[model samples]
Target: MARRKRRKTRVVITGISGRLGQLLTRRLHRLEDHEIIGIDRRFFRRRPKDVEHLRIDIRRKACEDLFRTKKIDVIYHLGLMHDPRRGSQEHHTWNILGTQRVFDYARRHGVPKVVLLSSTDVYGPQDDNPAFISEDAPLLGAQRFSQIRDLISVDMMAQSYFWKAPEIETVVLRPVHILGGVDNAMSNYLRLQRPPVIFGFDPMMQVIHEEDMVSAIHAAATPGLRGIYNVTGPDALPLRRLVGLAGKKPLEMPHVLAPTIARQAWMMRLLDAPAAELEYLRFAVTVDGSRAKQLLRLNPQYSAADSARAALRLGAWDAPSDAANQAEDSKGATAA
Candidate 1:
């Protein structure tokens, strides 16, 4: 009789309801040799047909129950609240404590690897530094809503897990200004009428396409790699240029005036919009991805302009009923 073949290893991902999680799940589902499992509190609208999805809050103790049944080989922890949400405290519970729960589960279950999605926001404001800030650069003082919490969580996870479980490799991917066809806060800002609001001189903006983000996660899971790595697009451009690429113009505003203006415009009520958004406007935040490219062999295909256009064409932002007329008037006023 022929020998029995071993079943392929299964990989689980958190935050299946989120934009990045949805896209990553669809991509990973297409791989024939792996089984994909997605976990989230809410249901996904467009779940891949081949993937298995479990609805459970990672913050709850019940999350450990699922691990007993599935032999998970890898865990991709990508769940977290972006800015503008009123859930910073909840985000910490879910992002930090939830991560700890998953890490504990993986270690106990003998999972070989885990990838934690982090942000370049940890590298705080870059005022005088060079354009491409490498991973070696220090994580400076915080200015944004997500920066402080992300830094604290990543640092704690790195220290606690890396030394304890050497066999269960843990990797962190720090990405900056993630842009793609996903509906997000930054993409919403791009959809506003031209003469788009600018807090000060348009600072240099660096972005990463969502597909490249998935690629970096895949690279992290590949054996023999463990540590933190910065993932970003190859180029950095002025924020105004990026706005123009989305067919919008920049409207200069003083940093001191943004809070009042944003509040008056009633834009602060939007998801992830708050006074914290204005802090990033005063300085440039860039990242050096040479290490990701050299080590992970990741080649990002999309440019900042490409990401801008894709975001617009995909209708990632909601437009008001009179948006066309307002856009036309803004264009006429600018041309005149």
Candidate 2:
């Protein structure tokens, strides 16, 4: 009898309902002869018919058992809490313990590769540094308790997994300010009022388009790749200029006074103004992507201005119909 060829393996992704995970699932499903499994707590609005959806919390031990039983080939870990109020205990339970359980299952099931998604906020606040900071730069410990716990979870998982299972290829992607058609914490502020609130004169912001972020993760899992890479877009823009580009005027607000203003806004029920979230607005963090560019061969298609224009044109601020139509025409002209 002739020898039979082995079947092509399947790839599993956690946090499938997230913006990045949804994009990735869609992209991978377009490829021929590859199986994609998505695991998320909530059911996604529009998942491909062929893609298998598993509604499960990764923090639970049973999820690990399910993975071990299925014997998935590659796993992408993209689940984590960003809310500052969640505190260290919650962060450890969800991010660290959850990751460890998944990692253990992958090891037992002989999973080939794992890609862990981390945040560029791990670099901490850069007050006035103009140049981009690379992956080689030391990780500034998270200032807030929530961030500290999240970063620690990622670090411990990455380091321990690498040490224990040298054979399993593990890669970490730290993305900065992921934007594009998503109601993320950062972009929510952009949607607030006409001429978004700006903190100080020089709050430099760098953003990574959601598409490019997914591409980087895809590249990481494509056989023979390991190590950490910082993923960001081409340029960093000042908050004021970014707001202006979004077709909104910029209202300069002093960082010191923002707390008081935010408190009042919260009292008035104008904005969800938690103190921790307010602190995040007051600082700036930027990341360099030279290594990602060179290694992943990724050239992010969207610039900061492009993203701002797109978000504005998408009517994120709920502009009047006439104003939105005019902005759309202007965006078209600029693109041309």
lDDT of each: 0.72, 0.71
Query: Against the true structure, what is each candidate's TM-score?
Result: 0.85, 0.82
**Structure candidate 2, residue pairs in collision:** none
Tens digits of lDDT, candidate 1, 1-336: 598867876888998778778766765665667788888888778666878877878867777777887788889888765544445676566667788888889888888888888777777765676688887776663544543665456555765688888888888888877776666656766766644455547788887766667778888888888887888774888888888888887777777777787666656454345555665666787778888888888877666776786566442432323433543554575469
| Candidate 2 per-residue C-alpha lDDT over 1-336 given as tens digits, one digit per residue, 9 for 90 to 100 | 598856656888898887778778766876655688888888787787888887988876667666767767789988765554455577667777778877787788788899988877676664554367777776664554234546656765786788799888888888887776665656656666754354554567788666567778888887888888888775888777777766676666777787687668766767653444554455577777888888888877666776765554221332336434654665576579
Model 2, runs deviating above 4 Å:
1-6, 84-89, 128-130, 144-148, 194-200, 263-269, 277-283, 310-336
lDDT against true structure, model 1: 0.72
Worst 10 residues of 1 by lDDT: 315-324
